[model samples]
Structures are given as C-alpha cells and as structure tokens.
Target: MKRGLLFPTTLLLLLLLGTIHAQPTPDPLDGGDYAQVYARAQAGGDAVTASRAAAAMTEYRAGGRDWTARAVQAARQATTTRPGDPDAQLALGSALGLQARAGGYTLGALNTAQQARAALDRALSLAPDRPDIQAVLAEWHAGAWAKAGIFSGGNQDRARTLATAAARRAPDTLFVQAHAGIALSLIHDSQARATLTRAATLNADTPLERDLQTQAKRVLEGLKP
Candidate 1:
C-alpha cells in the first residue's frame, strides 16, 4: 500500500513540473502586433490597410525605439509594395522621421533623416494638396535646420512656407496643426505658442490624431519664455 502511494505521488509531482516547464514565456515585443497587420495588408495588396497599419505601429510608444523600428520596417514594406501610393510614402517618411528623432545625431540617425526627407518629398510630389504631408515635411525641414544649419542645406524659410501652406490646407486637422506648431517653434516664431496651444486643445478624431495632440501638448509645455 505504501509503495503504491509513493509511486502515484511521484508521478503527480513529475507531471506538475513538466507542466510548469512547458509554459511559454511572454514576449517583450508583443506590442508590435501592427507588424502582423501590415503583413496581412501586404499579402492583400491593400495600400490603405498597409498605411494604417504602419501608422498604428508608430503609435505604439510604450515599446520604445524597438517598436518604432518595427514601424519603419512596416512602412518601408508598404512603400515598396505600392510605389505610387502617396499614403505609403507618407507613412514611411513619418516612421523614418520618428526613428531619426529618437536616435538623435548619430551617423545612422542622420542617414535615416535623409531617407525620411526623400520619402516625404516623394509623398509631397505625389499629393501636393495633402496637408498632413506638407506639415510633416515642414517639421522635417525645421528639424534639419535646427540640427545642421543652413550651410548643410537645411532651410528654415522653406520650413516656414511649408508650415503655412499646411495650416492653410487643413485648418481643422490636429496632425497638421501640431506639426505646423512644431515647425514654427523650431524657428522660434512668436506664433508657435498660440499654434501649439490651439493644437493641444483640438479634438482628435483618431488614435494618430490623439498622439499628435499629446505631442503638441508636450511641446507647448517645453517651450521657453
């Protein structure tokens, strides 16, 4: 009786241990689900879906730079799959710009920034009337000007023109307003504070718009007197 009880107890313990050992570890990068969505969009040849997925991936700020890199990869794939799609090009440019900002002035970051500028220029050429693209391009030019100066070909005047154009094109879009605010702030324009304040108070229609609003608020808080 005792021997039989011991065998049963040992078997139960071994089974429990096996179950514990078989449990899967949680993924740290699980926040990158947008990559899978982008893959599906690619498989379906849906440029709109691909662009949305790329934008969604960029919104995953909790995942940090790794997540942003995934956004860049997804955006790049979208652009490659739909070379003529303005939205795809815009998504790529946005992701690259975010990555460049996060990485700062490293050589790799500078290279990525150049790629972002090219992508944004392509998007602007494809859809000259797109306010979001114009605003983003304005911010890009302003950022370049702030970082590298006019001798390096960065143009604050061009940034201001693009920002003004974007604001005129889409006065109601939070994305455009926020980016325009950023461009103006980079040049230390007096209107930056008012634009950023207005952008922060605007209603966000989508998750991306909400993120832009949040960014605007942060910039507003950081502005110097």
Candidate 2:
C-alpha cells in the first residue's frame, strides 16, 4: 500500500512540473495587448485608457511605420471621443510629433508638425499647469526654429519663453529639465549645461524617462566648454 501511494504521488508531482513547464512566458508586447486596450477604451468611452494605449504603442512599437500609424489613429480616437480631455489631446499631439520626427524635415513633416502644434495648443489651453506638455511644446518650437523656412513657422524667442516656463514649473521632472536644457542649448544659454547635468543625474523610472536622461547626457557632451 505504501509503495502504491508513493508511485501515485511521484506521478502527480511529475504531471504538475510538466504543466508548469508547458506554460508560455509572457511577451513584452503581450501579443499586441495595446490593440485590445485601445478597443476596450473605445467601447467603454474611456479617453484615459485610449491615450495610454496610444502612448504605449508609440513607445513599444518605436520604429515601425505601421505602429506609429496605429498610435496616431488611437490618439485621434481618444481626442475625438473626449474633446475636453487634455491628456487625450496631448497624446494626439505627441503621436503626430513622433510621426513628424520619423519623416524628418520634409514638407509632409512640416505639415504634421503644424497639426501637432495645434493639438498641443489645445491641450495647453485645457491644462496650462502641465509641465510635461509645456516642455514638449517648447521642444516643438525649438525644433521648428532650427529647421525654419518659408513653409514652417518657428520662433526661437517663443521657444525660449516656453522652455523657461516649463523649467520654472517643474524643476524636478526629468522631462522638463532635459527638454528645456536642449532648447536652451540651441540658443547657447549659459545655464544649459547645469540643467542637462541635473537631468542626466536624475533616476529614470520609465523607458521614456531613461530616453530623456540619455538625451540630456548627449546634449551635455555636445556643449562647448
């Protein structure tokens, strides 16, 4: 009886182990989970979730054109579904900016940049206290100023003012610090190095924050002594 009980127990343990081993590991992309989130957001009329899904797709799908397109679509849906949601408008602007960056400084890119500016302006109007959005708007102005021409409206002075405001509003946030530092660097501001150094030294809690830290470091290295 004892031998028969031991055999059955060992078989049960073996089966448990086999079942555990057969379970698939979770994928980082989670088999395109962003799509499901976006779908759910749409079905539930949830602007926040839609924006989150759009932003996640932009970050996770990085260099893929299809991913960027989908991100733009989701962001647009979010903004349209909740016209008063500042976060949704911000997401839409950010997605459009990403697409513009991917396209470089072509006419299409300039056009997209203008649209991004419009969306960002709307977000700012809705939530003027958000430092992150201010930083992005500053960066947009700075980038446009750097590549300004007949087709693009870019004002360096406006960029400087916006960057200064963002820095003042959120001195501790890496996003504000890094972007403001970069914008200041473009005009050869004396404080750019210190701001970028602070940004680089800050601990990053997310992939986006890490990217901002990396950018700060690169900009700091490029500054003249």
- What's the count of clashing pairs in each model shown? 0, 0
Give Cα distance to truth, residue 122, candidate 1, Å: 0.3
- In the predicted model 1, the residue pairs found to clash are none
- RMSD (CA, angstroms), candidate 1: 15.5
lDDT of 1 by residue, 162-195 (tens): 9988887777777788999999899887878888
**TM-score for all models, in order of appearance:** 0.74, 0.72
Q: What Cα-based lDDT does every candidate model obtain?
A: 0.79, 0.77
lDDT per residue for candidate 2 within 1-225, as digits (tens), equals 999899999999999999999997542323456767767876787755665565556655453666677668877877877889887888888888778877886889988989989998999999998887887788777777777643567667877888888888888888799988888787677877887888998888666567568778998999999
Cα deviation of 131, candidate 1, in Å: 0.8
Stretch of 10 with least lDDT, candidate 1: 25-34
Ten contiguous residues minimizing lDDT sum, candidate 2: 25-34
- Candidate 2 — what's its lDDT? 0.77
